[model samples]
Target: MKKETQIGYRVSAICGAVALAFAGLHAMPAQAHGKNDVKHVLLISFDGLHEQDVARCIGSNACPNLALLAKSGVTYTNAHTPHLSDSFPGLAALLTGGSPKSAGLFYDVSYDRTLYAPLDSTCTGAQGWNVVFDETTGIDAKGGGPLINLDGGGAFNPDAIPYAKVGGVCTPVYPHNYIKTNTVFEVVKEHIRGSRTAWADKHAWGYDWVNGPSGKGVDDLARTEINSIDPKTGTYYLDTYTHTEVFDNIHVQALINEIDGLDSTGKTSAAVPTVFGTNFQTLSVAQKSPVADNGGYLDADFTPGPQVAAAITYLDGALGRVVSELKQRNLYSSTLIIVTAKHGQSPTDHTKLVKNGDTLTKLLEASNYLDSSGNFGQNNTTTGNLNDGSGLSGTGFVQTDDVGLIWLRDQSQKDAVVKTLKANLGCTAPGICADGPQAYILHGERLEHWFGDPANGRTPDIIVQPNPGVIYTSSKSKDEEHGGNAPDDSHLGLVVSFPGLHHGGRTDDRYVYTTQVAPTILSALDLDPDLLHSVQVEGTRTLPGLGIEHEHSQDRD
Candidate 1:
């Protein structure tokens, strides 16, 4: 048998032992309800959504279903994501009740200490630090020829991908196995009887990673491959007009099926999911489209272009379908609906858009911080191919979007590298750089203050924050991106609606983090929020202002 297969068996045995260790833990009573009330909790995420967009859509009557949800629950106007918000960290915060510090998740494509690149044979090769498990790495080359299976259920090949070494054992780090902490799904299943969880997401890879360590958190995982290449056309479907919008409907339909007690495969006799949800990418896609007014927002004013307006209408309609389904099944009053975003898009104002003249990679390459032969350009040919690790491990590896993160191999060169970066692109003042767009450089201990320390294995050594409208890429295909400290990226929409809340339709101005969602869900179900390992480490609290108390509160040792 192959080494990865043997390791998989060993890991499976370890997970089984861990599950058995906790199997005897008794289920807790429902805190906010009696034995017969509030049995289901549905959590939904709308990617790239901003709080202002939600207000604008509801105020202008562009989204009647969202307005109705707000009328029946509480809307948090000042809610925000972590300072350095990305989809991976954002979702981890929601499901783990912790920030990147506690959850050990920064982005889908990030650095790791003990993981080896699949293409590298030395195991300690320079490319080993570069572990990517996204769509490109997880594509299934069978049946339809690179077509993503929405219901594949961890069907991707593990041996072909990079593996992470834990306790001297190397195991294929599939999406469902990457997370370092337990998710709300595991908490629900371990603490509640007959509790099954389901989720649908954009990629089959990163989304499945939410199953947490034991690899059994989510019962049904629907992988809607948004960027799959069409076998017949030999082109990426997401590049086509309104293709993502059409594909999003499939996930919404899956939610309906799950609510109706059908499996993601459309088979009956499946148990209804206790906690089920999916994400909407229409708004994010619309916002980034180069076409003006293509069903996305125009500027910070949130004036919906035709496409953005239509996307909002479509998402609102999807929510309406979920509500109608629950009501029809007499499950509406028993469900908790959460409307929020994984991350907000940047450059909300098109007029302020600035193409970075001197990219960070060029500056780093010139400084000898990057491999001399490596193609550190916008294409990222070397890192993308997982080849030529040469300078990546010893020198440093830089990852960028709207923001930039640098992981250095030698701690002694930190001061020199930071000094060089400042000389090239550092801001003169808070947000004003000498050349190019305004930028802020954070290094040394400041990195730990904002995004934890590099010793944690996931935190970056240095962070680059540019002006709201500044982007590193020159690609004309997108107008805006996320992953920065700007208000446009950090601020997001958040709402919590339940049947027995004290106040409905009232807006709260409290400053709450998205990480609070995990603990709150546990509390609502009468399960201890501290059951989530990260929650205990971070002391994350349940979202306040819901006017409901958890039945029991205990800290996990």
Candidate 2:
């Protein structure tokens, strides 16, 4: 048998469903992490954290814990997430060692022609559904209302799950099985005997992808609801930075509980996960909050306003708490803490934000690509409802934020649609603003080359990348948006901090992709990066300078 297959079979037998006891290594020693000495990989993602944000926060002393983390680790100044920086693919890259091409997660809300609609369970439908596994997939989404009950209404609702014919029977495709690649958690869990895996994030149902293919990768996934209604106020948990901080704190405490060798709720004692982390949304919420001076920089120089500054301060304090807990538990030296972002918000310069109403969709509708009432691609984060599919036009799917992603009812019309888009580059048509910024249309071979082919049933038939700072919505609530091809949208801050990583700290400016983090995590734990499907297929490598790679990104430990 092939070595990879053998390893998989062997580990699958060992890493069973039942929890196992971990050794008494807690009393081993408290020392700095050395090469090949990493036992725990703490991957922390500060969502919407930009490379410039880190540099400026450190220089300004606004983020002391972040500065210290950078001091003890190597910072990749030019690390970036996948193109068209949506959180689904962005986080997928960090944990799966793949891009949209290999990971097969185009966006959190995208179109798939091969899958039946959520309500279609008889193995029959038009064979296309707008895949929205966001907060709307939560149990509270039953009435098309706000996510009220916390804990994401007990995760994704059965009715909200998209079904398809697998083998010969129609079955629901969970987020864990939807993605094309295996994640670090899956590889680590299966490879390391008795080692636990855990994670915490903003979504309850939306983050199931972290579990990887087998759906058992994350032993403890804290389901903090980012969009649950604040019962006392009848507002979403994401309505204000203050509420967002509260939502983020629930997960932070969950991570602390995990470090304490307990479950995410601290109610049950469990083995500390071998691989674990959480993504913070305070910065993201701050950057996107529409309140005046609540987000974005004061200028192109990246000066933080009061709210952004406060958000960074909260993030630093949160990091400091984690560090202190690690030291208290003596896991500091044995843990490798990686700090980065799933994606970055755009238009760091608030002045550049251009908001308009549904121009791209209007253009497509006017061009006959979509019926007059047809709309597709419905992941609008600014909308009051979460995991919202109510706006789906039942004709086509076109999701827009800073970018326009279209999946046509008929894929053969892609060429003609592209022709119409090209003809209206200036968008002088009445459907679109004559004075609006021209967009770059990616269709046909070009779109397929970067992402996968549209024939895959998941890739958008066409993508529209407007000029930077142009958000597709005219909502007055947020200062920035993501999911675009802009520099600010993709660029992210990356810091790999171990106890004694580089002695005095170092910075690597090489263009590294977030996909490398997955392989690097495995390498740190003395596991094989090739165990990951994407790492092997995409040639993803470990971060440079770690002893995990003798030659950096090549040559195993």
Candidate 3:
């Protein structure tokens, strides 16, 4: 009845399907590794992390644990994620060795024609926004109603969204539905021998794939508590809590449990999962956690810089705990550890940006440029459609902190939209919008590079590039934000600490991108690069200081 209940039922069905599928696959005994064989890989993602933060921690001696890791490991200075580095897209590239081109993950919640409707089309007509489908609804689109329909059925509590009042519905598209390709974990499990895998994370983009022990490569893991669909009859349900809490409490606890099992079971010889990861709740801590950001009603802020620092310390402690456990069990030195982030955040001051003198906002309002709902770019007003090329009026527009995604008012209006934007918002006037390096009019090859399917859903006419100091926020604009292509959001940290590393203590400024993370991991594991489906994107070469000798003859390859 309730949407939450339906979500639970759907999650259970997926797990059931996974179990059935796994049962059909042949099972094999755990393989033992020869002496000196690397036994573990630990990958951790720090949400909203900048390269400077790592450097600051090292310089300030604030992160002693990470410092020790840096001293022993290789710290890559030029690692980066692709432009417009959002979490889902960034992680998609990290795990799949591809961009939106192959991964089909363009944004935090992108459109999927086969599995789910695009966000704008998924919702019921009156809801004003598109409906995001749930598993219970299935592909047929049955049993979906205003979110009230699900909450009314006693599925999930309606306290968060006021679905009863606004007729809102939240049908999350699961990871399997979102990702179109296999990840490095899946490849490793399928091809490698005598290896086990595990993962933990709060975000659906990364760890949800590892929910159960089947398709997800993790032999043991924790997913964002399963989405509950059935209040009383559902088979699976994550306790109602925020993702940050789940990551800090349940996900981290699950990792600890796995470590404890490995230690107590004396199962070092038992094929242990070679790859394991956990993404700490740094964003929530930095912007909202310990405080609810007015129950998700306020804009994001970097005001809690100290809280972010505290979270970093806490996560480092967790890292120490895991590493200590491994060492106590005599498995530490053999493991390869990596620390990085999905992307970084930008500093924005909504208070200053919203004043009448906020030239950019005034420009949009003067041009009769209405967002999705026929309203001019109003202050603190979100959830409007953009200038979509659809016949609908006011189809596309900008909202929040200056980030605009244009939905053409008609298919023919695309050119007009581009022309109007380049002329009106082209940074010429004091009141016009400012375009950053990340902001560009994608067409032809560039558009195709980011979206495999441009026909159904890729992006709108233009992606409003947030300036370096701006972020996209809901209420009160924001104090800080991401979703831009600034160096802060794109530049990331890459730390590789393992035996056989060149003690060269070298830091090369060579260009590297997130597309290289997967290949790097696979290469570290002594696996073939081709297996991960990586094509050596421009500037994506191997790490230089790994002590793994590369022949100059084959270097051209």
Candidate 4:
């Protein structure tokens, strides 16, 4: 959908929130000294989870742990991710309370017109540059495969970082610097005295952004790396359904360790995080793997396939472990457990699947639009294998999954590119394309309304939201993908659970965005939500129906 119409969703979300603002006024938890007793906030992002997934699992009693949590929580049946549901933007929405337009992050690997390449330390002829800091940005890749270091080779190599102009001087832009907004971690640490923070995720290298712009948001950020090869078995942790489960376990163990007042490794003593969590990858992998071994669903309804069912069972067990630990420490009543997702998988119906081998790029290259690399994706072989970052290497930088993100070799050629792209909406050769619905292209004012103008760096010149089930991929390794405006891609499951919740299991259908999580976390800790940089700029609202009195956040519409 064009951002023009896509933004209407946010307008509606505000209306829903306002209508339900006082619906749960009587359900406020027993306050302590005019504030909530919540000392910790555990945010679990089961990446690629849907609101229907929670409903189906809860109705069928498949996820008892989640159901129990829901029993004492407010289930926001209409929660959603931002327009571009890539993992980076998805997480940014949660941590910054800012949409991409304000946050200045579109995708994990995007392009910018103002920055220079990493190697251009001297800022020679500084101009546009491609930005890529994904798993490829690590330093310990073994023969172009799994990484060797569990910490993703420690900090990022200088050669892979981008150079941005700070105070009119070229400086290396680390992952944390890439974000234009402050994070919840920063607010918690700076405003709340003696508060420590930690986080765990699949990668250890690129996620330094979790530390926020100051570079000290998270104190004990975990160093666990899921992309690393197991030294003993030589098996890649993400190669199979079973292997992915092992990766999720590592993150879960880290969270459990944090709950026990220890570091992620469980060897060092550290303060429990004031605001900390991890993103689960098992379900995401299962949804992408082959339908045979890691099937997503058995029917168009939310019925889980064998593999998906197994993944959900494992996630619920992991959640149970976390809850058990909280109860053991008598922290359950004072901790707010938020279960949500970064984004949701697309095309739940396998019959509607569409796989056209990178049609958008094919169309662009056919018309002679080329970046430094001859094609799309990160192909900078000059930087060591681990430094394979996505950037201006390709023609105008094109990253396509369910949606197409085009940065264009020449911004002046945008009209011509749109003419060519619109001409070839039909499925081209190579893979299946079940004709189901039409796609929309966003450019000019329609695109700029949601993201900023393309004249500035970072925002893509054009965006393509393909017909519901279409994914631009020639590979046969996976069935579903995210990173788009598809229905399933943006519609997410969100829950705010605590033992003190009075109106437990209350299903709140008010539309909400995950960006609201940042302010809600601060409010739960009895801190001013205004302390968040983006919260002040975006006027981000807290989750309604949670009657916890928030400081200076009610002004948000």
Backbone atom clashes (below 3 Å) for every candidate: 7, 9, 41, 6
Q: 1 or 3: which has the higher lDDT?
A: 1
TM-score of each: 0.85, 0.88, 0.66, 0.90
**Model 1 over residues 48-166: C-alpha lDDT tens digits?**
88899899888988888889888777788988886767788888889998887777777776776556655444355543365555554444632224544443334664423555665
When 1 and 4 are scored with lDDT, the better candidate is: 4
Q: 200-268 in candidate 2: lDDT tens per residue?
A: 887788889899989999999888778887777888878778788888888789889999989999999
Clashing pairs in 1: 31-551, 175-209, 294-307, 295-307, 295-308, 296-307, 296-308
Candidate 2, residue 335: Cα displacement in angstroms equals: 0.5
lDDT of 3 by residue, 188-271 (tens): 676666666777554322334332223555554443322323234433222222334433654555555555555212344334
Which TM-score value belongs to model 3? 0.66
lDDT of 3: 0.48
lDDT of 3 at 226: 29
Model 4 has an lDDT value of 0.77
Candidate 3: worst 10 consecutive residues by lDDT? 1-10
State the displacement of the C-alpha of residue 90, model 2, in Å, after optimal TM-score superposition. Answer: 0.8
- Scored by lDDT, model 1 comes in at 0.70
Please, what is the whole-model Cα lDDT of each candidate in the order they appear? 0.70, 0.77, 0.48, 0.77
lDDT of 2 at 454: 85
Which pairs of residues collide in model 2? 136-386, 136-387, 290-477, 290-478, 376-397, 376-398, 377-397, 377-398, 377-399
